[model samples]
Target chain A: MLDQQKVFYGILGLAVLATLGWGMSTAGPAGLAFAGAASFTIGGALMCLWERSIVRSAFSLMATFCGVGVLFILLGADFVGMAQILIYVGGILALLLFGVMLSPPDMTERKLVRVGGGLLTMGLGVAWVAGKVAATVKWAALPIDQLPEPKSHAEEIGVAFIHPEQYVVPFELAAVLLTVALVAAVYIARRKMSDFVPEVASQQENA
Target chain B: MLSNITTTAATTAAAAAPSENVVFHLLAEYVPEGVPGWILPIVTASISVGIVIALISVMAMGFTWLERKVSGHIQCRYGPMYAGGWHGWAQPIADGVKLLMKEDLIPIGADKALFMMAPAIVLGAIFGAFVAMPLAPDFYFADVNLGIFFILGMSSLTTIGVVMAGWSSNSKWSLYGAMREAAQVVAYEIPLGISLLVPLIVAGTFNLREASELQGDFYGMGWFVFKNPFMLPASILFFIAALAETKRAPFDLPEAESELVAGFLTEYSGIRWSFFFMEEYAAMYLMCLVASVFFFGGFESPFTYMAREQFGPNAFITNVVAASTLIVKSIAGIVLMMWVRWTLPRVRIDQVMTIGYKYLTPLALICVLGAACWEAIF
Candidate 1:
């Protein structure tokens, strides 16, 4: 088991070095930083899959989200980058961790059918992403002059979200959906004093 | 014609924008002419990191001593008056040495690796958040476009560290503390961010330095609170959320000493415990600094105004005055927080959730709506 763990870690390290080499050749000095982030993203995903501890695996998912945020920043999407971290790592990841923390700890059971299904889904997902990357060339290379001259695109993004012709409907819909979800969560998570109070009262009388 | 006009306009606007970072310019000016240009960014980053870390360390020390004195006074006690004389001025230094000399222990049941890594992660997240905080108009670690967003996101990362520390300790108290932290963060984070929208809308920018500069009109007295009435309530909401976010008294269920016996710090001791406290103090100061920038006048005071008026806007003395003003304001804010901590009793866990979710969140939303409407009108 120890040797297997070592081999897995060794593969992750080699993948990092390979990405760094590729990044350096393509983007020079900045490419090194990009490669580092890319490797971190991949490593975090692998760690998430490989970790036995549920809590640690949930946190590895956060590491992956944060790595994606850095990649967004490097690609010059500052608003998207910060928002990704704010919404995902800060908000959703916290919920994910909370759910994992509150659940039963002895959920280490392995099933053959589930494993087969997971493997098939993972294989298909990887192939789809790989094919898309091959299909796209220079999607990131926007002309400098054509880009808007705003240091912070937050205000523009806010406007776009609420614009009549743009995302206003979907934005409002998402808000409503979240409110419904929150209400449903409150109902589910609320304390059931109806059952507990009577039991406590009976025990008190006996005492 | 439209494309041509945009090309020229974009080029000119980009040129007029301030040099990416002020530190880079200062480094370029002082360094030897023969040095490579690429090395300057590395040097500047190193210097900025050193400055921020030093500032955090010194601030933590000062706040520790101050907290002791403040709490003592509030409770009608002398409070450590002997160490280094003068109301125990050197008490923090003594404590630092004592903590350093203590044994570092990990409980047998604790996850050894995570037990060690937790404090580092907590401290490192705050350090990353400080990268966006500007002390003066020209001095900052990083001039992030979405400065407040970056700070908020980075600071929230501390919750992960705190949770990890709690879980890895394998103690019942630690788990309870982590659970409370999770609940509190979920309840209060929305109100915290929404309250800030009142000022963010008024300033029309997310960059702290730009927000500060925009308020420098009328001899540096034009705070956002003056421009919008909702900002007052928003600022109030922000402070409450800040208190809860930093786990101050009244919302400090996560580390409730009376109940949980130090909660998440049940297993942490020596310098590791000190790491958690350092992160707390640093985060408190960061929250206050954000408040001062968004609601109060950041780096804008009569002294700064006078210095700028006397020595011109570009003068070094103006920056000095500005930095001092910001420091004083943040210290005042921290003191206010400490005062509340001494004055108020800790609320029950249920009350905390109710106040945060039922009261603060709605009030924050109302403030946001009012501010938006006010801006739309007059």
Candidate 2:
């Protein structure tokens, strides 16, 4: 099973690399972006299917995040791309792995079971979305040639967040929201002093 | 008169343009025209990767030797003196050869795929961070606009590698080490990033090369560490946070030798173990380079006249001087780290968190705020 999985991933990785190389030679940045997107989506799906281990699944998620970051970089959103990696891989994934590791062993080891009817429904839903996207979008009419030269958006985004005429309010609101969430999370995770006191008293009475 | 003006403008523009001496441009000249568009970038990338790998390997070997000697002197003993005659100059090489010949081991019931992939991921994260590092004015792989941010982001990926290694090892010790590493990295990263922002705020740029160039005046006095009163504290904060980030003592709880028996490394053997070791030293050097770039005059010498005025006309000389200066400064930073490691006792895991969250984080935040105000006022 391990060897089979290796072959599957090996082929997938090679295909992605080949696509990336071809795209770079022929269609340039747009091709690379497309290839990155395809690799992330397809590779992530395959990893989810092949890996029974939850921890390995989390690693696949990190790869998907990295692919998204690559797409952002290709689109000239360098700051966003880095932020994607920092926030998703560094912050979220670490928390996720910690949670997984700390959880009950049995819960962590449960294999992903597939339901036949659910798979059919998921496939149909995906097909419908693809059809809708195809119908609504004019892919051939994209102005690939007219695309502007790639440039960094770091300064622009930074200034925009603080500029009164730009996204200042939204920026402050986001900060406030994050602070609130952080406080709430700490509140939930913290061990209450009152509960600890009661447990200590019970232990003392037993002694 | 118009021609004179045009000629002067042209000269200025030429000077402002990126130097033709950069590795990328040099590689570009070697490619035959009309061959293929992708071939140039591919070739350039391959060469850049080759150069970085070779440099990193040599540095790793040198650092391992230095570390042993440092550790030996601190303990009042000679370390590896016989490996290559005087001072064990060839000790790392011998160790590498031995490691290569050693039998590779996989523990029973270990996840083979992840076990194999972990080291590669760790090394890849470390190498990717090098992409944005400007070794000299004309000696970088890529000068991304968000260069510092890119490095920070890539460095964070190492946590995933650590987690993978620990879990895949199928050992209690490995799991403990991995968890500790994950927690420590996540904790330290906040202060590390916030402290880094002080320099970014002062420079008003995220590009490391630009930041370094910004400090290329005042004969090194203009470096960010001395730019403001707050900057000195900020640099110290960054260094301490960096120590934690690299898992150097007193923050080396993850692999605490007295406690976890090499921690996550308990299961690793041979070349696989060496990969982790190399990555550690490489990361230490990378953080040192980052420190020099952010706080000290990166490639710029204290004697600005020598770096900028005298040798400015010769691109090659200027690049070489700049590269040497940066390396020297980085080595100094590495030595400082070693000094701290040998001097201080290891902190417990809880104390590490307390230092990171309660002390370092708030101090860094205050420094950022102060630096911003300082910039605005003066």
* TM-scores for candidates 1 onward, in order: 0.89, 0.90
lDDT of 2 by residue, B206-282 (tens): 87778888887776557888887788898999999999888889888878889999888889999999999898899
Q: What is the lDDT of residue A90 in candidate 1?
A: 75
lDDT, model 2, position B93: 97
Q: After TM-score superposition, what is the CA distance of residue A187 in candidate 2 from its true location, in Å? A: 1.9
* Model 2 segments more than 4 A misplaced: A1-33, A103-115, A144-148, A198-200, A204-207, B1-21
lDDT of each: 0.81, 0.78
- The candidates score, on chain A by TM-score, as follows 0.75, 0.76
Model 1: per-residue Cα lDDT over B227-248, one tens digit each: 9989999999999999999999
Query: Which regions of candidate 1 are displaced past 4 Å?
Result: A1-3, A104-128, A135-151, A187-207, B1-22, B30-37
